[model samples]
Target: MSKNKKLDIDLLVDGLTCIDNYSNDGFVNIPTDKSALHPARYFKELFMSELIKDGVSDEDIVAELDLSDQNFEEFLNEKAMVTSLLAQRLCVVTDMPAAFWLRAQSRFDDFHTRVE
Candidate 1:
């Protein structure tokens, strides 16, 4: 596998740990909640990084997503949740399956149980 793939997997594992900690505690105070553990978040982060790497600027993504500057800022800051519509747009943009996000969550949980 590529180095980026390994890095993404590691990040996913970290995300899983964060989710577990939140579940055990009453609350989580991260910029985003356990939703970061969602596959969409991972895919979004990676996709955005790749886009930036490929010379796509934040402004470009905002334009492509048809998001207003303020809304796009909120999205980048994780102050606003990604809607299903946005997720669909991302799936189309990245050619990734929406189910991948759900499956990532399931895989993380499964790994957690196996390791514990």
Candidate 2:
């Protein structure tokens, strides 16, 4: 990943923890205006990217995730919420800590501000 992209992920993760206290609910209850720092979309994106990198086709990913194309797109767009199960799937597939997404979000936000 590019440096900026990595920073964005870090910011996203940190923001998730900071805003929601890293609750186990899998939903970050941030205000709509604060959505940029939310981890849902970030997690989904990372999950999808990893799956793709692992040679999983988009169709297969959608099927495995039990999501329709439109729904998947909506989730990617941050217009739909993801369940805790989906988060767990991401963590499992990426071999990343379950809390990694939240921390990445936070670090991304912090890095962006520092650079700007």
Q: Any runs in candidate 2 off by more than 4 Å, and if so which? A: 1-8, 11-36, 85-116
Q: Over all chains combined, what TM-score does candidate 2 have? A: 0.45
Which stretches of candidate 1 lie above 4 Å from their native place? 1-8, 15-44, 101-116
- Residue 82, model 2: lDDT of 40
For candidate 1, give the lDDT.
Answer: 0.52
| lDDT of residue 12 for candidate 1 | 47
Q: Report the C-alpha lDDT of model 2 over 1-116, residue by residue, as the tens digit.
A: 11112212334433343453333444333322243444555655555666677777878866766777998777667665445565565455455544555454454466557658
Per-residue lDDT, model 1, residue 61, is 77
TM-score of each: 0.52, 0.45
* Model 2 weakest lDDT span, ten residues long: 1-10
